[model samples]
Target chain A: MPAPMPDISRQYQRREQLTMLALAFPALLMILLLVVLPVGWLAWQSIWHDGFTLENYRRILAEDIYWRSFALTFEISLTVTVLAVLLGYPIAYAASIVSRGWSIVILALVVLPFWTSVLVRAYAWLALLQRTGVINQLLRQLGLIDAPLALVHNTFGTVVATLHILLPFMVLPLYATMQKIPRDLLQAGASLGAGPVLTFWQIFLPLSLPGVLAGCTLVFVLSLGFYITPELLGGGRTVMVSMLVSRNVELYDQWGAASAVGVVLLLAVAAIFFVVSRFVPLDRVLGQR
Target chain B: MVRIVAQPSATQRGRPLDKGGESVDIRSASKHYDAVRALDNVSLNVAPREFVSLLGPSGSGKTTLLGILGGFIPPSSGSIHFGDRDVTLLPPHKRDIGVVFQNYALFPHMSVGENVAFPLRARQLPKADWPDKVRAALAMVGLAGYESRGISQLSGGQRQRVALARAMIFEPRLILMDEPLSALDKQLREAMQIELRELHKRIGATIIYVTHDQREALTMSDRVAILKDGKLVQIDKPQRLHDHPADSFVASFIGEASLLPVRRADACSVVLGPAILRSTRPVPDGDELMLAVHSEKLLIDDGAGDAARNRLTGKVTDVVYQGESLRVFLQLADGTSLSLRQPSHYEAARRIPPLGGELTVTLHPEDTIVVPKARP
Candidate 1:
C-alpha cells in the first residue's frame, strides 16, 4: 500500500476545505444575486435601449432639460462636498487628538443622526426651510428682514440638507485616517522649530490629504444621487438628476428615459471614482481595499 | 572587613560633572494619577553629550519620564531645566527635542528624502543648506542613495534608518529615542544598535534612550539607569552594574544570573547555598541576599583537581551548542540548577558532559555578585 493512502491527516485536510467552502458559498451567492446582479442589469438596461438604437444616449446628450439637471446635480454635489469637507475636517481633527472618552462621545454624537430615517431628515429640513418657517420668523422678529427671506424650496435648502446627512460619512473616514498618524511627526516638526500652525499645515495637512480626498469623494458621490433631500427641500425649483429621473418614471412613465438618466448618474459616479483612483492609490487613501 | 557608606565623598562625589557640558535636569519631578504614583520624586541629570539609557521593565515609569522630558506629557509636580532654561511648562512643540519613536513613525505619504528634510524645512534653515543637511543625515545612517524611495519600499531596518535621519536632521541639542531598534530582527537589531551607538558618539549630542532590553541598553549607553516599580533602583556604568548590581532585580534583569538564594553574614560578605562571597558593599544586618553569578564566570570540567578558586560539583542538565559558546545547565550538589556559559573554542581531552552527567564547575568569590534581595 503506497504510503497507506497518504495518512489520515490528508483526509482531515480535505474535509476541512470542503467544510469551509460549504459554509461560505451560500452567503456569497446571496450577495451576488441581490446586489451585484441588480447593478449589472441596471447598466445593461441603460445601454441596450432596444436594438442598440443609441437614441437614449442622443437624447441625454442633446436635450437641454437633461443637461440642465445634470449640471445642477454636479454643481450642488461639488458645493456640498466642499462644505462637508470644511465642517468635517475640524470635527475629525478634534476627535483624533482629544482624550479617548471625549472622542468616543463626539464620534457617537456625529453618528447619532445616521440612525434616524433619511425621510425624516428631509422633512425636518422642509419644516425649517419653508416660506414661513422658523428661520424666517426669527429673522423677521430680529428685524433683519421685514418680509420672509425665501429660505426654503431652493438649491440652498437642498445643499444644506444633503450636507447635514452626509457629514458623518465624511468625518468618520477622515478621523480613522487621522487616528493612524503618529503624534510623533507633529512633535518632530515642532521640535525643528515649526510653530503649531505651521506644523499643522506643513506636516499634518499633507499627511491627512488621503483622508480628505476620501471624505470629499464619499460626500460628492453620495450627494449626486440624493433624491428625497432635493425633492423635499428644493420643491422642484432646484431639479437635480435624481429628481428629474424620478419625475420621468413616476409622473411621465418614461422607462427608457429614466433608465438613460440612471445610466448617466452611474457614469458620473464612475468617472469621479476613476479620476480619484488615478491620483490617489485607493488602498492607501482609504487605508484598505 | 569592609565599610560601604559611599566611600566618603572627596569632592562631592555624586555631584554631576560641571566642567562645561549641556545639562538636562528634572528637579524633584513626580507624576500621580488620582492617588497612585507613576513617578515618585524622580530626578535625573544628563550632561551634555552623554548617552543615558533608561533600562526598566513595563510599568517602571520610564516611558512616563521620557514623555515628560519630550514634552508629550507634563509632570504633575516639578520643573525641568535644559542647560539654563526652565521649560517644564512648555508644550511639546516648544521643547525642541528630536524624538525617534519605537514604531519609527515615518510618514508613508512622503518620500524618505521628504521625511528627512521635514525637520530642516520646518526649522526654516537657510534654504540652500536643506538638501545638503538631508543628504548628509541620510548618508550618516548608510542610506545615502535611498532618499527618494517610498516608505513601503524600505525594509524594517531601512525604515529605522530613515527615522534616525529625520531625528538627526535638525541637530537638536537633545534626541530622545524610545526603543528605536526594538522592531528589527535580532541580527539587524544588533547591527543597528552598533550603528546607532557609533552615530551617537560621532555626533556628540545628548541622547536619552529608553528600552526594556538590558543588552541594548548596556551596549549603547554611557550610563544606564535601572528603574523598577516607578522608582530609580540604581544608575551606574554598565560594567559596574554588571559586576555589582545594587539589588537582586538589577542583577537578574541585566543578564542571565543563577541568583541562588543566600543570607548575609556580615558587611561585604554573604553565604550562598554552599559558598560564601565577600563583596565591595556592606551587607545589612537583616538583609537576605542572593548571588548574581554570571554564567560566563564559571568554568566547568569533568576531571579537574583543586586548581580553581572555588569548586562545586553538579550534573549537567542541558547543553546548547551556540556557535560561539556552549551554554551548559548545571545542577549543583544541593539540587539548585545553575547555568555555565563556556567558550565554544574551549578545548579539552574529556568528552563534553552529556545530560544528567555530573561535573564540577569553578567560580571566584568576587565573580559571584552578592545582591541584596528586595523587600516585598
Candidate 2:
C-alpha cells in the first residue's frame, strides 16, 4: 500500500527473515519427520493391538519379569552413577589442586578410555572381569580366593562395565566445573571460619551440583538405552529393556511389541528429565563448559 | 555494668577480642612454588589498631603475604604471631580473621542480612546477638534499610559497603583487605577510600590493606610497605615514603618523578654527568646513588643563573602545556635529560623557554630526596 517499488532496508530485512526460515525449514522438518514421527508412531503402537487396546501395557505392568528388568536397569544405573560420583569427585578435586601439567596428565588418564569404542571397552571389561581374567588370577595368586569369582554376564558385570565407560563422562564435566569455581572462594570460606569439611559441604558441594546433575542425567538416560555394554556384559542373564526390545523386534519379529517397549523407555527418560529439570535448567546445566 | 574481661580469661574463653590489641608479627615468612619464591623472608610487623597497606606492582607478593595472614596459604618458612601469641601453624578457620576480597565476594545466594550475619554465625555467636550486630554493622556502613535486597540489586559502592559490614560483623581482631575497592569505579573507589578511613578511625581495629593503587594507599594508610620482587623494600609513613623514598624503586613507584643518575665525588658533593654538584650532606662514595627530583621541584629561569646553587645548564627539548602547569623537558650538554613541571601560575616557563634554547635550572638540596642504591 505504501510503495510500488522496493524499499531496500525493508525488502532486505524481509528477504533475510524469509531466507533464514527457508534454510532452516528442511532441517526442522527432518527432525520432526525422522525423530518426532517415529516417536509418535511408537506411542500409537504402544496402546493399540489392532485399533486401540491397553493389553501390551497391561502385560508389561502386570508381569514381574518386565518389572524386574525395569527395576534392575534403574537400580544398576543409579548405583553406578553414585559410585562414579564418589570415585570421580576426589580425582577431579585433586586435578584442580595440582599443577597444570600434572592436572592435564591425570585428566587425560581419566578421560583416555572415552576415545575408544564403547563396545570395545565393554569387551575389554569382559576380558578383565570374566571368570578366569587377570582380576581373579591375581586374587588366586594373592590367596584371597580359592576359585575365580563370577564377574561377567550378570548385573555386577553390567554395572562394572558401564561405570568404566561412563567414568570419563562424569569426571571430565566435574573437573571442568571444579576448575571454574575460583580457588579463592574455598579459601575465603576457610578464612571466614568454615573448616575444610564445612567448606566442602557448603561451597564446593553445592557449586558442583550442576555438573553432578548433568553427569547423572546423561549416565541415567544413556544407561536406559544401553544396548552394547549390558548386552555384551549382561550375558543373556540380564535382559534389560533395550535387549528386550531388540529381542522382540529381531528374534520374535514383533514390531508392535518392540515399538511399545520403546515408547515406554522413551517416556521413562522423558519423565526422569522432567523431574530433574525442575531443580535445574537442564539445558543450561548440560550446555555449560 | 563493667565486666572485668581479663585477657587471660578472655583468651581462655576463646574470644578474639582479648587478642585484639597488639601488632601482628610476620617473621621470615616465605612461600615457594617449586623453585619460584612468591614471598621471601618477609618479616613485617603490623602495629595494633593501625592501618597498614601493602603497596606493590602485580605479582610482587603483597597479596601472598595477605593470603598467608588471611590463612589462605601456608608459608614455606617462618611463623606468624597474632598480638604476642604465635599462631603460625593454625588453619584458617582456627584463626579468627575477617577478609574482604577485591571482588567483594558477597554470597550471591544470600540476602544482605544473611551475608552480614555470616561471620557472627561462624563464631557461633548467640542467636540473640546476631540481629543487633547485623543492624549495627549495616548502620555503621550506612547501608540501613537494605537488608532484604539481593546482591544483584546493589550498586558497586553498596556491594563494597555490604562486604565491609560482613567482614567486621564479629569485630575481628584484624581485617585483611585484599584490594577491596579495586573492582569499583574511580569515583566510587575514591569515595570508599574516604569512607574506609573514617571507619578505621571509628572502629580503631588493626587492618592490613593490600593494593596496587599507590594513590589509594598513600591517601588512606598510616604506613605503607612497598614490596618488590617478593621483598619488603621500604615501610614508612605516607609523607616519608613520598618525600624521602628509601630507593629509586620507591621514588618511582610512589609517585611521578624524574631520576637523574649522579656520582659521589667527595663529602657534600656529587657530579651529575659533567656538572659537579655540592650537597648539604655527605652522600657515601663507591655506591651507585640516584638523585630523585620531583618535576615540580625544579625551577627554570631564562636569565643567567651563575648565582644558583646546584645549578645546571641544559637545552630545552620539549615543553608540554598542562592545564594547571607546564612540564619542561631539558637535555644537558652531557646528554642527560630531565623534566621540570611547575604550576601555570608560575609563568616563567612561557616567556623564554624554546626548544633547543639553553636554559638554566636549579635543584635545591633540601628539596632533593637522597635515595639509596639498588639492592643486588
Candidate 3:
C-alpha cells in the first residue's frame, strides 16, 4: 500500500540523452566536415566525368604501370613492417627490463626522434646516406670501398628512411605492453623449472603478441600511403600508391584517375583493418584491455 | 621419505605424485645489501616431509630467508644442502624446488592444462605423458577436468588451487610458499590453510611456508620459526611456543598475551606488585622479567581455590561481550592491567561482577609463564 509515483524517470532519461548528444556534437561535426566530405567528394569525382562513368577505374585495372606501383607499395610496406618488428622488439624489451633511470634514457632516445619533423629526419638520413655522404666518406677513408655504394634512390633507401620515420609507432605500443607484464611471472617461470631462454620463448613472447600485431599494423598501414620519405630518398626510383596518386593529379591533371587511386588505397587500408581485427581484437592490440 | 610413483596410469584418480621430498640443511645463511643485513647469520635444519613455517612481521627478513632457500637471492655467506647435494650456488631452475609466489603468478595467456604442463615440458617429458600428468595434478588440487579453463575465467581461490597444482605437478621434493593465501578472503584463507595442511601430508614434500599470520602458522606447521628484526627469536612446536616463549617478544607475538613487568624473587618465583607469582619452571636469568598473562589461563578465585595456585586481587575496569566469551579487563593496585576471558553463557554472565568491583583471580604454577624482557 504505497501510492503510485509519478513517471518522471523516463523524462529525466530523455533529458540526459539530449545532454550527451549535445556534448558529442562538436566531435561528430568535425568528422563530418573533415573526413566524410573529402571522401565523398573523392568518390564523386572518381565516378563522375561529364555525367557518370567507370572508365577511370577500368583504366587502372588495365594499366601495367598502376599495377606495378600497387605491387611495389605492398612489397616495400611488408619489408618495412617486418624490419621494424625485428629492430623495435629488442629496444622495447631493453627499455622494459632496465632500471628506472636507464629506462628513462632509452625511452627518451626513442621519443626524441619522434618529436622532430619527419622531413628533418629524412633529410638527416639523406645527408648521411647520399653519394659522398658521411657514411661513404667514412667507408672510403677506412679503405673499405673503392667507390661510393648506391645507398639512396632505390628500394633500400626507401625502406631505411621509412623504417626510421615509423619506428616509434612500432616501439611505443610494444613498450607499453611489455611494461605491463609483471616481473613476478619470470620468477614463477624459473621456479617452475624453466630456464631463461625457455621462459622467454613460452611465456614472454606469447604475452607480448598483441604489441607485435599492433606495431606491425601501424607500420604496414602507414607505409602503404607513404610519400615524403620515399619521394625524397627514392629519387623517383621507388613509386608507391601515394606517389602515383600525386602524379595523376599534380603532373597529369587527371582528377578522375587520382580520385580512383585514392579510393582504392582507402579501401585497401580498410580491408587490412577488418582482417586484422577479425584475427585479434583491436582493443587488445591498442592495450585498452 | 621420498616416494616416487613410476608413471601414474592415465585413468588414475586423486593420486598425487609422491616424489621430491629431501631434507634441507641451511648452515649460517646470511644476506647483506650494502650495510643493511637482510638476513643475519641464521642456521636451520628441516627434515624430509616436514612442514615448517617462517612466521614474522614485515621487514623481519622472512622473505629474504625464503629467497635464500629458493635460490632467488644468493646468500652473502652460507652453505645449503638438499639431502646430500650442496646447492648453495645453484640457480632457481636447477634447484628442483617448487615455489608458490604471492598472488599466484599464473600465466595469463595459458589455459590451466598448458600452465600445469609447462614444468614437464621444460624437463622435456614425453608429449604423451602430459594429459595424464596434468589430469592427476589437477585432480590432486580438487580441480579435475579444469584443463581447458582460461586463467581469467577463475576466482581467486581457484587461481590459488591452480598455482598449487602447477607447482606440485613436477613432483619437486621441496616447496617454498611466500604468503600464497594472503590474497584470499578470510573464510577462504582458513579453509585453504586446512586444505594445504592435508595436501602436504598427501604429497610428502618438505614445505617451507612464509606468513605473517600467527594463527595460520599455528594451525598448519609441525614447527614454527618466529623471527623479528632479521633474527630468529624462537623455533618450536605450536604449543611449546605458546606456553614457553623464549622471551617477551615471542610471547606477545605468538598469542593474545598481556606482558606485565616483574622482578625475579627466586629460582621459581617472581614478585609482581605485592603478590609473589610462582612458576613450575625456574625463573630465567635476567635483571628484568615479564609475566605473560594468557587470557584463558586465569580462573576466578573462590575461597576453596587450590593451595598450589597463586592469587592476585584487582578492580574490574571493563567487561566486553564477545559472543561465546566475555573479556574482563582488570587493574592491579600498582596500575598494571590484566585481562581474562570468561564463558559468556547465562550462569557465567550472571556471576560476573559489575564494573569497578573487586575481583580475585588465581593462576596455577604450571600456567604461569615468565621470560626475560627483550631489548627494545
For residues A199-232, write the lDDT of model 2, one tens digit per residue: 7877788778777877777777777788899999
Please give, for residues A1-289, the per-residue lDDT of candidate 1 as tens digits: 4555557888899999999999999999999999789878866766675566667778889989888889999999999999999999999999999999999999999999999999998988877878688788888889999978776788899898999999999999899888977887776666656788988887789878888988988888889889988888897789999887788889998777777888878877888788878877876676673
Tens digits of per-residue lDDT, candidate 1, B297-347, equal 877644455443566678888988888888888887777788888777757
Task: Please report how far candidate 3 places residue B46 from its true position, in Å.
Answer: 0.9
Candidate 2 wrong stretches, greater than 4 Å: A1-68, A124-153, B1-20, B273-276, B302-313, B321-325, B344-359
**Top lDDT model:** 3
Residue A34 shift from truth in candidate 1, angstroms? 4.5
TM-score of 2: 0.85
Tens digits of per-residue lDDT, candidate 3, A185-283, equal 988999889999999999899889989998998889899989999999999979899999999999999999999999998998889789878877987
Each predicted complex: what DockQ? Answer: 0.54, 0.54, 0.73
| Residue B209 of model 1, lDDT score | 93
DockQ of candidate 1 (2 decimals): 0.54
- Candidate 2 lDDT over B210-302, as tens digits, reads 999999999999999999989999999999998878888999888778777888787777778877777675575657888887887777654
Better candidate number, 1 or 2, judged by lDDT: 2
Clashing pairs in 3: B3-B18, B20-B173, B21-B173
Please identify model 1 stretches exceeding 4 Å from their true place.
Answer: A1-62, A283-289, B1-21, B273-282, B301-311, B345-358
